[model samples]
Target: MQHIIDMISNGTKMNESEHDELINEVSAELVELYEIEYDPDNLIPADDETANRILEAAFDLLEAVGVYSVDTKSVFTIPRDEIFRSVQNSQRYLNIGEGSDKYLLTLAGSSEKKKTSIMGGPNASPVTPEMFIPIHRSYAKYTDIDSIAPAYLDVPAGSAKKGPANLMKARQAVQLVKEACALEGRPDMCITTPPHIEDPVAAVSVANPRFMGSGDLQEIIPQQGLKVNYSELSRVYHYKMTGSNYLCSPMLVRGLSAATPEQFAIEIAAEALKSQVVYGASVFFKYPAHIHTGDPLKTLWASFAATQALSKNEICLQGSVVTSSAGPCTEMMFYETAVQTIGYVVCGCDILSGPVSNNGSITNQVSGLDAHFMAEVSRFASDLSLKDANYLCNELFSRYESKLNAPEIGKPFVDCYDMNTIEPTQEYWKLYETVIADIYYILQQKNRRISRR
Candidate 1:
């Protein structure tokens, strides 16, 4: 924490342009210098050598460019030696939740014996107060799901996310998730910290043993393109003192600072390495995305490549988030979730988080069904080799490629799920079954295709 403070107080100052220029220049050079590669034909390619190369390039990028402090207008660079030592000594296994609901999160390899930890929920979808408990209970009821990543509570009718309302809402969000878990007979279920309030003070205040639980996962998010602020730095200190499990969640937009999938993967790996060393992040949440769309193929490929690199190098426990373009209750969403889930699990990510429908934009547009299907796919993909996983994802992508641009934004949670039973309606269930069967058929054909080869 003091080192972080020192970085802010004494680091060399640079304007936004200079910082971006340096990032761009260093990123371009690293890509060429390391011969970073991405196979568009085979998104989830079985290439460990390339994966290891990407990880090395990521470390080089960090040592050269460092992390930019948005608030301080300064750059905080760590030496390669320190980065290596920090990663070597960082936490690898994390125990979250308690008793019956407890689950282990470890930096898993691509072994058939490993079980991918599942964190299921609406995943930050906006929701009214009336729908919060029911939506979360639907996920908490699942025995396969290890943790709950609840939806964001929509601001009270006319109020904004500030003042006492913000603090109250933050506390309320945690309590509501706990209530949902208890209702489902899983009181010890791991509950992730929600964005009830954007203010760091209220966020931090509600994040205690009482609200979010010491065993729950809290996220310290970095700003886009390797940037950090005072708020996140403070949370790192607080979580450490409270002995809470936390993840360093970083977002990479493909076209923002990173020009291509290869660049994006490098940036993602660099951020993961830096976060593990700097924040002592118990886990790393990897989500590479396009700024405006949902479930872009290139973004998903980038996520797999980065995760493969990190997992291969044994950086930290990595969690994969599946943000779908389509909404719940649609056939397209089922396909989207399956493809993303397969890629992530094949890449050896330890945790599978989401299938957050509608790109996580629409209010009440997500359902437990999406989470359930994602879990199913993740479990099934655990035993799949990279070759099989690649064939399956490519086949699924081919079916949905044309519909990627204008996927159907299906019904809200209320429409597709029976609130009384907290289960999917018959129509939604049938669609899920149909998609599952179709995916299996595609896998069967993969066998024939391989034999023909």
Candidate 2:
């Protein structure tokens, strides 16, 4: 509490009343969420009535604490106690008496643009040579995003037709960073690379030359005007070999067929823990329900449970994206937004990077909206107590468990928001604003209760 206060006092500006209001609102919603979603034994009920109850509870909670700002992208830093209180008040709906539960608050960056600095091949969609400049421009424009995970840079030149070559791809990655920096006037943004690489030496060769690593964060210093940074790869080595403070994200889909999504997530998280790597997990959800028949909520729960088991030092949950084959739709986008935000709050993820749409296609304008929605939800979720957050998540899962596999992918970005304007359309923005306003009202209601007490 003192640390947060000191940080805020020392130039980290925050409006006390506004902050308190926000906290109170989220807390009250969480309390209601607890009643509907969480069982005292930490188990979720499987019945439809319980599920519907959980959904109603979550809807109220979402109405209260789920909306966030999409206009300005900034990190919110507030005291944990306030957040915990908000959740406690919300839990009153469940009749759970408020008890002392120390919560921790951390700053997180919220930028939804899918600008990969690393992977640039056929495997990664919409990453054409022509699209590079535009994407770079987008990155440059969104200076609010603290870091960027450059896409996988292993594809050799002229290999798109023949598939990726064995030739080291890191050097090319360096070139891409340099290019992206040159195009964007500001080169201060951090550049990160994928952890799963075939050649560590080549990967290092490219990163060591471009990036400066100090502790967990890496910075890309412009050498002829370009951002550069290297992140350790963790996919190939698995968690057992790496021991875990590195980024280790195995594709959820790939692991799902052979092992349960939860089991795969646990195995990967365990490896990250062993390496002490600040890991990132990407959970991809495809459309039509034919791909994976499992429950989305359960899959998310398994992933969160795995994340919870790991040491905070070893693993920092970078956000998870709900990817679908059907491209970015409104329902899918919202579903992803709701689930990922809830996961971040309940699971205590370090950074929330996406709601990546079209399985990696930049063509989906809705992807950007999804990103915006994610940022808003993330901000709301950040203001949650760990216990209440867990309960909230359990409730969300209970309500949306069946729909996970066959989630309704909403409208594409083109339909929802105008791409030409580089902002959400008025209609979309109105929807966004309404959601946020409702959430604000919920917070205000909670604040009034706090005053009475």
Candidate 3:
């Protein structure tokens, strides 16, 4: 109640300040008061008590700080009662995809165990028109990857076309994704639409029910200052009407938003929880912003705290893996990918796998191989308890810790795979095997010995 009053008073002060100034100010101030309780000895915090404490910290941050609306130019005052009501109305089960391809995505917490589905594709990365089909084909063939969101839209790449024409380009992305899935015999796949398209009406105009159907998920991202803008608001409305899902991803960059780990985690929770409270969106994701796939320490800390907070309170899910300076087909790339994805799975996230090579800069820099590697790492990492998961993260981090700055951006998909055959070259497979073998050894060292084994 005091924080709500404070936010109102702060809102008056905001008028005297610029937008970016207020944003930068809140981001810097929010996490400064909280000290990180993350143990160096136990990085993942295996105890249930620790997770609960993290949840408590997150709620306090949410109630005290609340969310800022760039559009309204005022802070959103949280009526505690209404926020709780929205949480009570939070969704527990979600049906993704259409027809026989549909899957009931059940949300779970860090304490409860459930198989996290593999949501694969380019995400929103840019790719050349020629490579889109072949790249998506890579993910579609894998049974482990349940849904697809093809990256690198060929339609809107490098002025090859005119204005964003959001609807036209979006339709092309959908049409192209269908082609890729069809080649892999998975025409009934669920995929994501780019948020660049601002108008929900235009998006619906392009989404032909006969092909696009009603099962697709679109991203609804709030502005950096935690404000829900018209673009995301309309998309939420579109989902409410269509009965589709929106992947609410509020990425809190380490340096940009929060200076420290504690602040970063709190910001993530504030965004995720607010998304649910405001929009009734259940599928939430927290991706740490870094060029080199981010660090395991950062990933585990922020993801564990925020996601544990969400899970404790609502029928919600949080997710994994984003942003890498490292490109595909290099040994260094696999090592970084292995460490980061493993950390996210162990920290507990609904895994969304893909190597956004070159920090999602260039197309053909990503391949099906990158997505495959992410899936494998996340699946293997999920098997370990938090204690062993932490050990594995520390060990793997030791290998790539030095390479975080200016990571080796290796060759893109064209160099690594046989486009016609849609398979990895022998050289790539050999490197992949070697990386997996080393990771296995790391996991083995951490795993307690069984008397029988």
Candidate 4:
């Protein structure tokens, strides 16, 4: 525990002043969160109490150093011994899915990647034993992702297929992991399976194992001494409700319905605490008129407030307008990325994921430039301290707040870039270069002022 503390607090040792400041800020924020108006009938007092306790522990650990990543919208801070002990004492493990030796190795390697901390694979697809080895090897070679999440296992809404066959898909996923282990020559991955236990057809049948059963996966995979990745638990939460729906409807709403941003955060933390898995919280920025009043600054502030209120865990607040609803243009894309990055930094998100455009649906060309631009800006902004980052984010938002409602989205991915070269078209690249230069200039000026101080 002391080792963990030292690892996290390497640069910024805690002083009395910093400790007091963190405690006061956290306490005040908790009070403010509790006072927010909500549908009273849906409130959960126990959840709120749990949230407060987590905050208290976080505050007491103020000596721990904290760092924010703009690319991921995630905040990484050291935990105090008491907090770690409390989490361990709570016995909060949620064994969701199956475990496999291969899957475990893939997960461990992915988790060690720099600047990337999450990996996800198709949950429904079944890979042949032949294909599984190559796929796992590809994953091992291509990306340095930290966690591998199960994707789309519960079959889409209109799929023609049915039933226990889904377990086959699960086995195939496990197979992919196993193949990867063979290629890597070392067993170092972590496997996590799904949580749903009750089979729909089984009114009372032991003959067929549940499709989403973690226990079944564990039983099948002969991997001993492997930890399961629990970060994917949120996927179950998403699957049971959202299924394959993409419009972000009541399904996503229900997941969030009962809790305030703060409360939801605590739930996320609790999940992380229980599983000891790397956890993430993300805020999807959709262009909702009522919430932001079409004011980008207000919208950014709202995002910041919500994300800040929920930064207890390894959370990432994704900031990007839904380009599908808004049309495409470079200026709107640039402004949105700038403001979003700023908000993410201020809110202390651990990882950040966009300058996303065309609603994250566009293909390479149109999307790549904005992604690259956003990534650069995010990287640049992350170099600043939280206070300065907040100031800049607020300033940018103030400048563009009036235009958020009708902000330009940008061209479709296929139409915007050259596929052969894997780069944006010349026109798009020129525009991106110009926008990036401008952002750098602004940041340079800010850096100068900070230096003078």
Query: Highest lDDT: which candidate?
Result: 1
Best by TM-score: 1
How do the candidates rank by TM-score, highest first?
A: 1, 3, 2, 4
**Which pairs clash inside model 3?**
125-152, 126-152, 127-152, 291-325
- Tens-digit lDDT string for candidate 2 (81-182): 443333322211111001211112132221221211111111233343444434434433443333444443323255532114322344454456446644
C-alpha TM-score for every candidate: 0.96, 0.50, 0.87, 0.44
**Candidate 1 lDDT tens digits, 1-453:** 787778767778888678777777778888888887777778895888778878988898888887888888888888899899989987877899988888877765555357888899887889888988898888888888889888889865777577787888888888998999999999989978885346788878876876887679887667767777888888888888888888787766776777777787888898888887778888888766552264466677777888888887788788877887888888888888888889888888898887788888899888877888888888898888888899889888787678877888899988998878988999999999999999888888878877999
Answer with 1 or 3, whichever has the higher lDDT. Answer: 1
lDDT of each: 0.82, 0.37, 0.66, 0.36
Q: In candidate 4, which residue ranges exceed 4 Å CA deviation? A: 1-329, 345-348, 354-356, 360-366, 398-400, 445-453
Off by over 4 Å in 1: 291-295
Rank candidates by lDDT, best first: 1, 3, 2, 4
Q: What lDDT tens digits, residue by residue, belong to model 3 across residues 1-453? A: 234334544663244135445445554454444444556566566666555555555556556555665545566556666666666677777777766678777766655666767787777677777887888888888777778766856554354233446556777777888888878877787876643454566555544575466677766655544555555666676667776667777655665645556666666776766777766775776656563444547545666666656665543666664556677777777876776676566656665646567777776677777777777877787777777777776787677668777677788777888878989899888988888899898776555464336
Question: How well is each residue in 94-177 modelled by candidate 4, as lDDT tens digits?
Answer: 221233322221111111221311222222122333334443343333223222222223333453332665445445455456
* Alpha carbon lDDT at 275, candidate 4: 26
